[model samples]
Target: MTRSLKKGPFVDYHLLKKVRSSDVLNKRIIKTWSRRSMIIPEMIGFTFAVHNGKNFIPVFVTENMVGHKLGEFSPTRVFKGHSGDKNSKNLKGSKNVVRKK
Candidate 1:
């Protein structure tokens, strides 16, 4: 569900303050744990280190990311892929198959 338009976008006060205090030309990464905070226009051109449970992931904010949640860029889960090696064994045996060139 989306936030109520009347309440406005949910931008963390502390995060905003940090962005304002830092110089954009310095290229310093602003570390933050507030993944739920929404990205605003003011955050453009700044790099953010958003916490993803175990570690912080770097998220470079651009104009296209405006209005999106910070968490959307930082993934929480590590995809190890599906179980079973049956497909791999079959593929190895089929290497001799003729190909349409």
Candidate 2:
């Protein structure tokens, strides 16, 4: 049986369903950030929002360190070169994703 959309614009109905159940969508978001060469499994955060459109609603969010970087930007933010601060050392001595309480 096909899944049903809860409510929203028709265009977003499709997109939201794709976002909700598609590993491909999730991986694409992750890879886009990774391609920009950001650190991961760090102190980045997650957020979700419901976008109501003319036709349907879409669930939108950000994930990983990329989210933190995006959030750090200010309207007057200026870009200097990367700090060259590779926190990769944090990965040493620990498993990739440690389940915390």
Candidate 3:
């Protein structure tokens, strides 16, 4: 039976049940899969590439991995500038903003 669960975002119980029933998920015992799964990797990958470069710079793609506007709230280095004054301000006139240890 489908049981409605109020996870952070709207998650359907049937879907959760199906995922839990799956061998892979059950084996791993994933209690509450976060929405960051797809995004975190991309951000890390971008960070890695930047770190490797002579001048590590954040480059926020205009669109996210899904090809839609990456929300200003979304953690990314690349700024679309179009995201508005705030986003543009967040990524002002410098490409090589150094990171602190």
Candidate 4:
């Protein structure tokens, strides 16, 4: 479920303060751990260093990214491949097989 329309978008007060005080954009990266906080128009053009559990990843907020969560830009999990041996005979279909001469 999304946030109630009556409450309005949830932007961290501290973050808003930091952003409001700064006038430069793309010059400094704002380091923050508020991944759950929603992105606002004031964040546009600013680059943020959002923490992804282990380290901080740079995230540049644009007009298109407004109303989205900070965490969406900084992914936490790494996608590996599916399990199983490539040479296993149990593999489906023998499309690449050739008959012995």
Instruction: Tell me the TM-score of model 4.
Output: 0.83
Model 1 Cα lDDT, one tens digit per residue, 2-50: 8899999998899999999998899999999999999999899999999
Alpha-carbon local distance difference test for all models: 0.94, 0.32, 0.34, 0.89
lDDT of 4 by residue, 1-101 (tens): 88898999987898989899997643788999999889988889899999999999999888999999999999999989788787775545666666678
Worst lDDT 10-window in candidate 2 = 30-39
| Residue 28 Cα positional deviation in candidate 3, in Å, after optimal superposition | 15
Which is better, 2 or 3, measured by lDDT? 3
Order of candidate numbers by TM-score, starting with the best:
1, 4, 3, 2
lDDT of 3 by residue, 1-101 (tens): 32244433333354345444555322332322222222222232222112212333333322244322223223435566654465555665677677688
**Pairs in steric clash, model 4:** none
* Candidate 2 RMSD to the real structure: 19.3
RMSD of 1: 4.6
lDDT of 2 by residue, 1-101 (tens): 32254641122233344344555334343212111122223212322222222222222233533323222321223478677546675766667857779
Q: Can you give the TM-score per candidate against the true fold?
A: 0.84, 0.18, 0.19, 0.83
